[model samples]
Target: MRIRFKLDGQDVEVDVKHTDTLLKVLKDRIGVGSVHFGCGEGSCGACMVLINGRLRYSCLTLAGYVDGKEVTTVAALARDGELTEIQRAFLENDAAQCGYCTPGMILTAKVLLEKNPSPSDEELFDALAGNLCRCTGYIPIINAIKSVSRR
Candidate 1:
């Protein structure tokens, strides 16, 4: 089957099998290496992506489910070779460590910031609760979200 969707601001059409998870199609067929597969069961949130502006675990989502939808990965958060404010904040606040979960975390934060802009600490935590970072312990990650929210 052929699936068509918008990826990182570009329209993309790729071949997919019925059982293909979004993560599989992305990393294998689409060559999007940033969508890591930590826990394919979706509990780890490592394969998170924005489908039509909603954060979803790509590992749990089928490629066929996203046809004609807008898919945004961590790679899409940059513009003209410049990082988005969320990305910059993550870097400045040392939110990423080991860099394994950074992509999903950043993309999740991006959706949260876009929707709330000035989310409270509780709201921020709730938004990022799904993304687990075993390396950073989430202190710096929460701070990074706060930093971007202020801007």
Candidate 2:
């Protein structure tokens, strides 16, 4: 099947099989580097991306389902080689350890901040519940998100 959608503010069209997961297409066909393949079952939030302004696990999303929809990844968060506010916050807070989950974590934080510019600690925890990071122990991650709210 042929699918057309807006990817990181650019219109994209590609031919894919109905059984193809969006994660596979994004990383393989589209060559998007931010969306990682941690757990293909969607249990891990590693393949997260914003679809139509909401977070979706690309691993579970079928390519056909994204036809005509808008998708945003951590790659879109930065512009002109400059770090985005959230990305900078993550760096300043030392939120990443192994960095395998940083992209997904950042995108999740981005959505949370967009909905609530100033989220409480508990709210922040709840928003990031799906994203798992084995390295930083989450304090730094939370602090990173909080720092962005301060901006």
Candidate 1 structure quality by residue, lDDT tens digits, 90-122: 889998888989999998888887788999888
TM-score of every candidate relative to the true structure: 0.93, 0.93
Measured with C-alpha atoms, the lDDT of residue 109 in candidate 1 is 85
Clashing pairs in 1: none
Tell me which residue pairs clash in candidate 2.
none
Model 2, which residues run further than 4 Å from truth? none
Q: What is the C-alpha lDDT of each candidate?
A: 0.88, 0.90
Q: For residue 86, give model 2's deviation from the true position in Å.
A: 0.9
Q: Write the per-residue lDDT of candidate 2 for residues 1-151, one digit (tens) a residue.
A: 9999999999999999989999999999989988899989977798999999899999999999999999998888788999999999999998988888988899889888888999888899999988888774599988889888944
